[model samples]
Target chain A: MSAPFAKLPRWADYGLIPLINLFVAFIVAGLVVMLVGENPFRAAMILVEGAFGRGQNIAYTLYYATNFIFTGLAVAVAFHAGLFNIGGEGQAYIAGLGVAFVALSLDTVLPWYLTFPIAIVAAAGFGALWALIPAYLQAKRDSHVVITTIMFNYIAGSLMVYMLVDVIKPLGSMAPQTRPFEAGAQLPKLNWIIELFGAKIRSAPLNLSFILALIMAYLVWLLIWRTKLGYEIRTLGFSSKAARYAGISESRIIIITMLISGALAGMMALNPTMGDQHNVSLDFVSQAGFVGIAVALMGRSHPAGIIPAAILFGALYQGGAELAFEMPNISRDMIVIIQGLVILFAGALEHMFRPTIQTLFASLSPRSVGLAAAKKEGA
Target chain B: MDFLNALVLILDSTIRLSVPLLLACLAGLYSERAGVFDIGLEGKMLAGAFAGAAGAAVTGSAWLGLLCGILVSVGMALVHGFASITHRGNQIVSGVAINFIAAGSTIILGQAWFQQGGRTPALGAAQRFEAIELPGAAALRDVPLIGQIYSELISGHSLLTYFAFLMVPFTWWVLYRTRFGLRLRAVGENPAAVDTAGVSVAWLRYRAVICTGILTGIAGCYLSMVQNAGFVKDMTAGKGFIALAALIFAKWKPVNAMFACLLFGFLDAASIRLQGTPIMGVRVPVQLMQALPYILTVILLAGFIGKAIPPRAGGVPYVKER
Candidate 1:
C-alpha cells in the first residue's frame, strides 16, 4: 500500500520532527512569557542559570528528573499497549502510603538497604493494586481506561486526605504528615556523584533513587524490545484484530502492561518519600504524574528519548521555582503553561508540519524521490 | 418541623450546586453525541469562570461577562476541532491539551491582568447575577407546605439557574425533534455514512463542539457571577468531571442527565451536611462523602449499575477511504 502521507527517512522522522516540535513549543511558551510583560530572553537566561548554574541547582534538577523518568517510563509502557494510563498521578499518590508504611514500621528496626528493598515492593504492590481495578474494567467491562483512570485519580486524592488526616497523623501533631523517617529509612544522597566532577556544592536531595530510575529505564528498554510479552504488547498496540488473529490475548496484555505502568508510577514516590523529604507529606507527587504525560509524549515513548526529555522538564521545574522568586510577574505557573504547550504541539498537533517537511525533503532529493517512485512501480 | 426545615435547606443547596453540573453535562452530551468526546469540559469551565469574573469586574455588567465567557470557551472548542478534526489527531490527547492550556493560561492571564494573585476582583451586586424572587414569593412564604416549597425551593434563584432547568427539555427537543440533531447523531454513530450522504461530517461535528462550548461557558459564568462574587484559582474544581459522569449515568439522554446531575448534587449537599454529624451513632468521615460521586461513577462505569455505551465512533478521527 502506498503511504497516505509521504514517509521521510528514519532520521528525519525521529530526530528532525521532534526537534522542530520542541522548538515550536518553546517559541509559543516564550510568547506567553512576553504576554505577561516579562522579557522572554531574560526569563530564559534566568531559567538556565537557575537550573544549571550551581552544583546544588544541578543536583536539584537531577532529583526532579529522577521522578519524571520513572513516571515517563510508566506512561511509555501503557502507551505501548494502546492504553492511556492517565491514572499515574493517582497510582503514584497512593503508593506513598506503602512507602511510608514500610518506613514507619521497618526504619527503626532494619537497615537502610533492607528498608529500601521492602519499600520498593510495597510501593510497586500498592500502585499495581490501584491500577488493577481500572485495568480490569477496561479489559473486561468495556469501561474506557481514560475516564476510569481520571476518576481513580480523584478517588485517590480523597483517600489520601482521609488516610493522612484520620489514620496516620500523630495524635499530638497538627500537620497531616508523619514524623520524619529514621536514618535507616532514608536513602543516601548522591552528592558524592556531583563531587566527583570537582564541583564544590551545597547538599541537594539527589539520591540513590536516581540510580534506580536509570536501571528501570534500561530494564524497560529490554522489556519492550526483547521480551515475548513486549512483542505481544507492541502487536496489540498496532492493531487488536491482528493481535487476536495471531492468538494473543488482548485482555491479558492490557492487564500486564497496566500493572507494569502502575508499578513504575508507584516507584516514583520513592524519589521524594525516601530520597528527599524522608516523610510522606500532603501532595508530594505535586503534578509529577501530569509531567510524565508531557515527558512521554516528547520522548516519543522510548527510554533513550525519555531520559533527556525528563531532564529538560526537570530543568523547567527547578528553574521555574527560581524564576518565580526572581520575577513577580511571571509565576511558577509559567512552567505549567510551557508543559501544556509542549503536550499540545508534541502529542496532539504532532503531524501539523509533517506534510510540508516531507515535501521539502522530497524536493531537495529528487534522485531519491525518483528511486522511491521506481521502486513503488516495480513493486 | 425542624427536620422538614433542614430537608428544604439541603434540597435548596442541591439545586444551587446542580446548575453548573447540569449545564456541563448537556455540553458533554452534545460533543459526545456528535462523536467528539470532550474531557476538557473542566478546563473550559475554569477558563470561563476566570473570563466571566474578569469581564464583569471590568464592565460592571454580568450579561457581558456571560458573553465573554461564551466567546472564550468557543475559541477553545475551535482549537479542539482544529486538532481533532482538521489534523485528525487523537481526540483524547487534544482534549487533554485543551484542559492543561486552559488551566494554566487562565491563572497566568488572571494574575497578569488583575494583579490579584490569580483571581479577579470581587464583583458587586450590580456586576453579578442576583437571586430573583418570584412574583408572589413574599406573600406565599407565610403559607404552609406548598408555599414553602414554591417560595424557598422554586423561587429565589439566579436567572441562570432557571435557564439551566429550562435547557433540559429544550435539549431533548433539539436532540430528538430537529433535523440538525438527527444529522449530528448520525454523524457520531457513523461519520462515513454521513459523508456518503453528502453532509459534511467535519462541519456537523464542529457545530456540536461549538454548542458544547456555549453550554460549558454558561456554566462557568454561573460559578463566578451567580454562585460566587469572583473567580478563584481552580474554582471549577472537579465539577467538569462530575458532569461527564452525570452524562454517562444518564446514558447520554438530555433529560436523564438533568436528573443524574441532581442526584449527584444532592449527594454533595448531603455530604456537606453530614460532615461532623453522627449517622446511626457512627461519625462518617468527610473524605468518604467527598469521594462518593467519583466512587459511584467508577462502579456505574463498570456496568454494575448498567452499561454506559458511548457513541460508536467516539474518540476516533474520521478518515475518508481513498
Candidate 2:
C-alpha cells in the first residue's frame, strides 16, 4: 500500500532493483535445484557454461534470444499505450499460418528471395489482422483486451489444428506439420554471412531473424522515443482523459499500437519455422510469447533494456535444455519455474524492495532527497 | 429411435462436461465478485488435479485425494492473495505468476515423485470416484422416453457432479440472501463503502479467493477422479480461462453462469460428435469445434450475444489514501 510513497534513486530505480530481483529469482531457483539434491553452485556454473561457453552454444542462445526479442518488444509497445496485450501468443500462432501459406503455395513458383519478402509480409500482416479484432472491440465495444486476446489464443490453436489435420497435411503424412519449405524459401543462416569476415563460426540455427529483430528493436526505439505518434501513445498510456483533452484519439492510438505489437509478435514465428524447422508445426511459437512478458517486465519496456533481458531468458532456455540432458533429476520444467520467479519478482513483486532501497539512497544523499520526493507515487 | 439415442448421448456428455465448468465458473464468480480478477483458475485447477491424482495414488482413497486437491488449490489462492491483496501488487501480473508457478511446480514435482512423465498412475476403482445410482432408477427403467432420460441423464453421474450443480443455488442464496454476500458484493463495487461500514475489505477478498480455490478444487478433482483416469501434465488445459469467459458471458451471476457453462459443454460435446462427420460431403472441422466456446465468448464480450458489465472496481487494488 505504501508503494506510491517509495521514491527510489535513478540508478537504484533503473539498474539496481532489476538486478537485485534477478539475483533473488536465481537464488530461489537455486534453492529449488538444491531441494532436488543437486549442488546449486554447480548447476549455476553448468548453466552459464552451457549457454555461453562454446561458439555453437552462443549461436543457439542468440537464436532463441531473437524470438524473445520479438515477443518482448510486442509487449512493450502495447504496455506503453496502457494496454496489456496478452494475445501475443495467439497472434504469433495465427501468424504461423501466414508463413506456412506463403511458403507452401508460392515457394515453388517464386525464387527464395521473392518468397522471403512475401512470407515476412504475410506473417506480420496476418498477426496484425488477428490483433485488429480485439483492438476494435476494446476501442469501440468496451471489451477487455486481456480476455479477448486469451480467447483468441484458443481460437488460433483450433485453427492450426484444423489446417494441419484436414486441410494441409500434404496427403499421407500422419504428422501434424507441413512439408518442409522449398530450398529457395529457407532463410539463410548467419554463418554464411558471418563467414565473410574470415571467422569460422559454425553453422547454427542463428539466422537472418536475429538481424531482423535488431532492426525491429531500433525501429521501436525510434517510434517510441522519436515520433509524434509515439508521444501521443505514451500520453494515452499515462492518462487517457488527458490525451483526449489534448485532441488525441484514444481509439486510433489503441488500434495502431496493437497492430504494431501484433506484427512484432507474428515475426517471432519466423525464428522457429523459417530459421530452424523449415516448416510449420503445432506450438512452434512454444512459450516464447509468454516469456516476452517477463522480458519486457525485466527490461522496463525499453528496447535498449530488452536486448540484454531477452538474452538472459535465452540463456536460461538453452541452459535448461543442456541441464535436462546432462542431469537426469533436474528437468526442463525447472526453466519455467525460473521464468516464473523472474516474472514474479520483476513484474508483480516489483516494488517490494523499493521502499527499503529508497530509504537507503535518501539517507546517503541529502540533495537528492528533495528531488526524489517529487517522484513519490500514490499513497 | 436411433436419432433419439444419439441425442441422449450428446446430452449426457454435455452434462458431464458442464460439471467442471460450472464449478469453475462459480469459483470465479466468488473471487471476481469480491474484486479479485483471477486469471489463475487454470493454475489452481491444474494444481488440484495433480494433488488429487497423486493423493489417490499414494493413499488409495478417493476421498483423501479430494481433500488434498482442495488444500493445494487453497495454497495457491493464498499465494495470490498475499501478492495482490497484501503486497498491493499488479493483480494480472500476480495471477500470471501463480499460473507459471502452478504449471512449472506441478510438472517438476510430479516428475520427481512419480517418474511417469509428470503423471500419476491410473487410479483403481476404490481410488477413483464411481457413478452413484439414484433411487427409483430401476422402477423408471420400464418407462419410455422418461426412462432413458432418468437413467442416462439423472441417475449415473458421480456425486461431485450433483454437488457442482447444487452449489449453483447455494451460491445464489449466499450471494443474494446472506449478510456476508452483501458485504462481498459491496467490496467489489466499492471497497471504500465496505471499509466505511466497518468491514475489512482485504479479509473479505481473501475469504472469497479461498472459496474460489475450494470450488475450483472440486472441478479439478472431478476431472482427475471422475471424468478421466488420472492427472496428466496441463490436464486442466484452458478450462479455467473458458470458465472465466463463461462468468463474463453470464454477467457474473451464479445461476446464469450455470446455463452458460452448460451451453459451452453442449458445444464441446457437439463438436466431438460432429468431428469428421461429413454433412452432405464436407467433414466438420474439429478445430472449429474446439474453438466454438472461445468464438462464442468473443461474441458475447463484443456485446453481440448480450450485455456484459463487469464489477466497477474489478482489477484495481483498493487503496485507502492518507
Candidate 3:
C-alpha cells in the first residue's frame, strides 16, 4: 500500500503539533467568550496579568501548579504502563485522610520537618491502597479499570463525607472538618523566594511543597527513564503482547505501575492540606486530579513536559479567579471550559490536523518524504 | 395503613427519580451496543438540561425546549463520533472532555445569558411538563391498596416518564426484532464482517450515536422541565454515572437495564426518606446509602454477581486491514 501520510519531523511532532492544538483550543475558548458578549482579547490579557502581574499572583500560580505537578506525574506514570488511572481524584482525596491523620497525631510533639516525611508516606500509602483494588480487578478479573476507577471516585466521595460528618468532625463543631493542625503541621510559605526577586508575597500559599513537587518531578524522571521497572513499564505500554512474549508478568507490571501512579496522586494532598489549608477541607483537592489528565495529555506524558504544562494550568486557575472577580459576566467556570477544550483538542482530536499538515510537508520536499518512507520500511 | 402509605410514597419518588436514569441507560445501551462506548452521558444530559431550560424559558414552549436540547446533545455526540470514530482517538478521553465541557460551559453560558448565577429563571407552568393523571384514577382512589399503587405509584407522572418506561419495551423490540437491530449488534460484535457485507460501519455507528443523543436529551429535558421546573448547575449530578452503573449491572440488556435503574432509584428514594431516621435503633449514615450504588456496581463488576462483558468491538475504532 502507498504510504498513508508523511512522517513528521521530530520538532513538528513533539512541539509544533501540540502548539497548534493549544492555539485551536484557545481560539475555541475565545469564541465561547465572544458568544457571552465579552471581548476575548481583553479577558485573555486580564487573565495573563492576574496570573503573573504581581509577586503574590505568581506565588498563587505556582501554588496551584504544585498540585498539578503531583497529579500530572501520577497520570504520566500510569500512561507509561498502558493504564488509565482516573481514580487520582479519589486517591488524592483519600490520601488527605492519611495526611490529616499523621498531621493531627504528630503536630503535638514533632516538628514540621519530622511530620512532613511521615505525612508523605501516609499519603502515598493510602493512595496506593486505594488503587490496589482496581489494579487487582483489571489484572486478575479482566474488569476494565476505567469504570471501576470512576466508581471508586464516587465511593471515595461518600467515604470522605462520612468520615468528615459522622466520625471525624469535632463535637460541637458546626462545620464538617477537623480542627486546624497546630503550627508544626503547617508547611512554611516560600515568601523568601518572592523576596529574593525584590518583591513581596502577599498572602499567597506558595510554600515548601513547590520544592517538593519539583524534587518529585526529578525523581519521577529518574524512575521512568533510569530504572529497570520504568523500562518494563514503557515496554508493556508499547505492546502488552510483545511484553508477554518477552516473559514480563503483565499482572505484576499493571499492579506495580498503578500503585506508583496512585502514590503520586496521593502526594497531591500535601500541597493543599498541609501547605495552604493546614487542615483537610472538603474540597481541598478541588478537581486537581482531573486537571492532571489534561496536563499529562498536553505534556505528552513526560515529566520534562509536565512541569511546563502544569504551570500553564496553574496560570489559568489563578488568572481565572481574577477574571471572575473583574468580569462579572465571565465566571471562573470559563477556565473549566478552556480546560475541556484543551483536553478535546490536545488529547482526543490530536490528529485532526495531522493529515493536512503531512500532505503540505510532503509537497514541500518530496525527497525528505521519500527518505522517511524508506527509513520506515528499513525499520 | 401508615406503612403502606410510606411504601407508596417511596415508590412514587422511585419512579420519578428512575425516569432520567432509565432514559439515559437506554441511551447508553444504544451507543455501546453499536460499539461506541459513551461515558459522556452525564455531560450530554447536563447540556440538554441547560438548553432545555433556556429554550423553554425563551419560547414559552416545552416542546421547543426539547428540540433545542436534542439539537445541542446531537452536536456533542457528533463531536465524540468525529474523534473516536474518524480520528480513532481514545473514547474515554473524548468522553471526559465532553463532560468537562458540558460542566463548565453550561454554567458559564447560564450565568452570562440569564444573570441568575448560572441558572435560568424558574420556569412558568406553561413552559413546564406538568404531570398527567391516568384515566380512571379518581374513581379508583377509594380502592385501598390497589388504589394507592395505581393512583399514587403509577398514575401521576409527566408525559416523559411514561415515554421512558415505554421506551424499554420499544428498545427491546428494536434490538431483537428489527433488521437494523441485527446489523447494529453484528457491527458492534464484529464490524469487519458487516463491512464485508457491504454496510458502512461508520454510518450505522453514527445513527446509534444520534439515537443516544435523542434519548439523553429527553432525559435532560425531563430533569429541567418536568422534575425541577428549572435548570441548576451540575443538576444532572452523578445520575449519569448511576445509569452507567445500571447499564453494567444489567449487562447491557434493555429489560434488565430498567430493573437495575429501578433498584438504584429505590436506593435513592429510600436514602432520602431514611435520612436522620434510625434504622433498627441505629442511625445509618446517609453517605453510606449514597455510596451504595457505586459500591454494589464495583462488586458486580468484580464478578461477585456475574461478569459484565461489553460489546466485543467496544471502544476500538474499525480499521480496515491494508
Off by over 4 Å in 3: A1-4, A366-379
lDDT of 1 by residue, A1-379 (tens): 4233456877888888988989999999999888989999999999999999988899999999999999999999999999999999999999999998999999999999999999999999999989999999999998999999999999999999999988998899999998899987999999888889887777799999999999999999999999999999999999999999999999999999999999999999999999998999899999999899999999999999999999999999999999988888888888888888888889889989898887777667734434456545655
- Predict model 2's lDDT versus the native: 0.89
Each prediction's RMSD to truth? 1.8, 2.7, 1.9
Q: Give the clash count for each candidate.
A: 0, 1, 0
DockQ of 3: 0.89
User: Which model scores highest in lDDT?
Assistant: 3
TM-score versus the correct structure, for each prediction: 0.98, 0.95, 0.98
Off by over 4 Å in 2: A1-6, A109-111, A192-203, A371-379, B279-282
Per-model DockQ: 0.79, 0.75, 0.89
| Interface C-alpha RMSD, model 3 | 0.6
* lDDT (10s digit) by residue, model 3, range A1-379: 4445577887788898999999999999999999999999999999999999999999999999999999999999999998998999999999999998999889989999999999999999999999999999999998999999999999999999889888788899988888899988999999789879998776989999899999999999999999998999999999999999988999999999999999999999999988998889786789999999999999999898999999999999999999999899999899889889999999889989888777777767656555555544755
Model 3 docking tier (incorrect/acceptable/medium/high): high
Measured by TM-score, how close is model 1 to the native structure? 0.98
- The lDDT ranking, best first, is 3, 1, 2
